[model samples]
Target: MKGNAELLARTDMIVAAGGGERDVAVDAAILTNKPKSANPEAFLNERLMSDLRPTLFLAQLSNLLAGNISIVHGVTGSSRTFMGEEAAGVDAVRVALARIEAGQSELALVGGSHNGEREDLLLLYDAGGHMLHAPFQPVWERRSGMVLGSLGAFLVLEARGHAEARNAKPLARLARVLSERSARPPGAVSAALTRMWQTLTPHGARAGMAVISGATGAQPATNEERAWLKSLAEVPVRATGSRVGHGLEPQFSMNIALATLALGREKLFPPADSSGVEREYEGPLERVAVTAVGHWRGEGMALVEAVT
Candidate 1:
C-alpha cells in the first residue's frame, strides 16, 4: 500500500478501537458561559466579577462528578490571568491531568475563557500541543483587532470502576486521549497541519478513522493551510467555525459538544450543517488536523485533537 493508504488504514483501526460507531450518553451535563442574561456587559461582569469564579466553579463542578473528571478551558488575554498564574495555554490542562494522575482530585474541571483583543482558543487530545500563549509574530502584531469574548466549559469524567461503584449512569467512556507536539514552527500553518497529522494517525499505524472540526477563516495563510490539508490522504475533515464563529473559549466547548454528540449518535456532524460553512472536504481525510491562527492574547495559539 502507498504511504497515504497505510496511514488511512491505521486511522481506521484507531477509530475502531476508540469505540467507533458507538453511541454514549453524557452521564452529566456540560454548561458553557450561559448565565441568566445574554447582554454583553452584564454577562461579562457576572463571569469576570463574581458569578463564575474559575477555581470555585471548578471545585463545585468537581463535586458533582462520580469519579475523575478532566476540565479544559481555553482563554485569551485578561481572563487567562484571572483563571490561574500559569503563563501557558495548556498549563491549566496539564494541571488537571497531573491531578488526575496523582489521585489528588477524583473529578477535575479543566477549561479556560478569555476576553481581550486578538483572542483564539483550541482543544487537543494531548496537552503538549496546546499553545498557552501566542508567540510574537511581526505580521500578526501589525493587525490591530482583538475583541475578547466570554466562553468556558467543564467536563465530568468518571472512571469505569468508579462509576460502577457509585452506580452512576455511564454516559461515555473515554477510550483514549493522545497529545503530541509537531516539529513545525509555532503558530505557522505547517505547524497546525503537522499536529493534525500526528493526531489522526492510528495506533501502531493500523486501521482507524476520525472526525475533526475547528475555526478556518480568511486570515493570512488560510489558503495555504487548506491546500496542505487537502493534499493529505483521504479522510473526513469538518470545520466547526461556521456555526460557532471564531474564538478559543467557545470553540473548546463547541468541539466538546460535537464529540459528545458523535459518541452518542455514532456519526459525524458536518461543519456545513453546524457552522454554516458552505465548502467542506470529506472522504479519506482520515488524518484529520485542526489549525487556529493568530495570538491568544496572554495564552498563545492552541491546536487540539480529540479522537475516540
Candidate 2:
C-alpha cells in the first residue's frame, strides 16, 4: 500500500500485478457448502444469493488488488493486471521491460504478490498433485511437495538518464526478460529453457553467473528444470521456493529481487540441499538467470547483470 501511494505515483507507467493464491481464503469461505446436485454451476447460481453473504465475489476476484492500488495510490496513468499464477508474474515483468525498451515508459513500477496460506488453495493444489505432504525439504530434494507461501513484492524501474538525473543508483541491470507458455508434452519445458538460454546467455554463461530458480517442487516440471540446470554444469543454482515456500504469483519477482540482492552482496546464498545438485563457485557473482516454471503451463527466464 505504501508503494502504491508513494513509489507507484512517481512512475510514468505503473505495472502492478500478481494473482495466484490471492483470494483463496475468501473463496474457501464462500464455497464451503458442497452441493449434492451434479451441476455445481447450477447450485452456485441458484443458491448464490441466499447461501452466501450478499455475493462476496468482489473479495474473491483477483483484480481487486490492482484496483485498490489505483484508488489508494492515485496512479491514474495506465493500469493493467495479468492472471494465470506463476506465468502472470513472469508476464508482468516481461511487459514492463518491453514497454521500457520501446521507450513507451521511462519510469515504471512492476512486480507481484501471493497469499498462499489457505486451506482451499492447498486442497486445490493437492488435488492436482502439487502440494507437499511430507516434512519441509529443499525444492530440489523433494520430487513432489510444494509448500505454499504468503508474500508480496514490487520493483521500481527507471531509464538510465531518469535515474541518473535523480541521482538514484540502481542495484542491478535487467538485461532482458524472456517468458513463454509451453504446451508441455514431456521434455518441452527443458527444450524451451535451453532455447531461451541460447538467446539470453550474453557472452557465454560462466560459473560466476548463477541461477535463481522458481521450481515449486511439483512433479515432472520441477524434475525437468533440475535436469536442465544440471546440464549447465558448474553454474551454481539456488532454488528460491525451497526457502520461501512457493508463492505462485510473486515467485518470479521475488526471485529476481533476490538475484539483485545477491549481485549486490557479491555472493550466492548457501545451497539448501545436501543432494550435491547445487554447487558453489569461487568466481565473482556477475549475472543471474531467474527462472519460473509454472505448476501447470508456463516456463520463463530473466537475465540480470551486475552493474559493475
Candidate 3:
C-alpha cells in the first residue's frame, strides 16, 4: 500500500536495505566470452563498460529506494537509509521513534526491504554457511542455518497527539524500543536481551502478554534467544520466520507490524512451530514484546501494548 496522501507528503522516511540484485546473465556472458577473446583483458573491460549501465549501478545504491518512494509517492520529507545486515532494521525504527519522542518529528515512515531470490545473494550467504540447503523447517526447530525470503515492509509511526489531531485511528501503542550490540560471545546475546527486557518492563511481564520473535533459525543466536525466552515462562512466543521465512533487513519492522495486528485483533495467531517453543494462546492479547536477535550481530526489543 502507498499510504494516505496527506500523511505521505510530510512523513520522514528511514529505510534499511542491502545491495541490489546483480545482472546474472551479463555476468555469465562475460565469463563465457572473455576467455575466448584474443585480448582477454581488453574484452573484459569493454563488456563491463557497456553492460553495466548507469541505471543498474544506481539500483545498487541503498538510498535509491527512498528517493524513488519520494518521487513516486510525493513523500518529499527528509530521508535516510541504513545498511548493516539486521541491525539496520532495528536502528531505522529506533531513530524514527527517538525523533518523534524528542519533538523533532511528528510523523515518520520506518522500515526496510530485502530481495532474497538472487544467485549472488544466495552464493554470498551459502559461502558463509548461513543458508539452509535441506528441506525447509520452522525457525525454532532448525538446528542451524536460515531460509531467506524476499519482502518489503514499512510502518507509519506518529506522535500520539499528532495522530489525534487528525482524528486518525491508532493501532497498538509503542511503549518502548531498545537496541544493543555485543561481541556475541557464548552468553552475550542472552545478556543483552535480559537488559533490554528489564528496561522495557521494569515491573516485570504482565498477563495477556505475548512475544513475536525474529529468530532467523541461525546457530547460536536462535539457541540463545530460545534460552532467554524461557525466562518469560507463560508468555506465548511466536517466531514469524516460520511463516514468512527470514527477510533480514525488514525482519524487525515485519515483526512489529505483526505485533500491532495481534494487539488490534486482541488475539495472537496460532503457533507456527510444533517444537515447545511456540504454543497456542487463546487469551485476549493486550501486550506484545517483539524481539530481534540478529543472526550475526545485533540485539533489540520493543514493547507494544493494546490501546485501551
TM-score for each candidate, following the candidate numbering: 0.45, 0.87, 0.95
Worst 10 residues of 1 by lDDT: 12-21
Q: Which residue pairs of candidate 3 clash?
A: none
Residue-level lDDT of model 2, residues 120-195, one tens digit each, is: 6778899998898878889888968788898877776667777787688899898898988767999998998988
lDDT for 195 in candidate 3 is 94
- Candidate 1 yields a Cα-based lDDT of 0.35
lDDT of 1 at 107: 44
Per-residue lDDT over 1-308 for candidate 1, one digit per residue giving the tens place of the 0 to 100 score: 12333222221100000000111121111124433356756665554564444543443332222112111221111111113111222343444434555665444434443322321122221132322233322221212222223344444444345546756565444333323333335445555555545554534242224444443343333444455555544445454544444344334434444555554555555545422222354333222233333222222122222333
Top candidate, metric TM-score = 3
* lDDT of all predictions: 0.35, 0.79, 0.89
Clashing pairs in 2: 132-145, 132-146
lDDT of prediction 3: 0.89
Question: Which parts of model 2 have CA positions greater than 4 angstroms off?
Answer: 1-56
- Model 3 earns a TM-score of 0.95
TM-score for candidate 2, residues paired by index: 0.87
Identify the candidate with maximal lDDT.
3
Ranking by TM-score: 3, 2, 1
lDDT of 3 by residue, 203-232 (tens): 895688899999998889999999999888
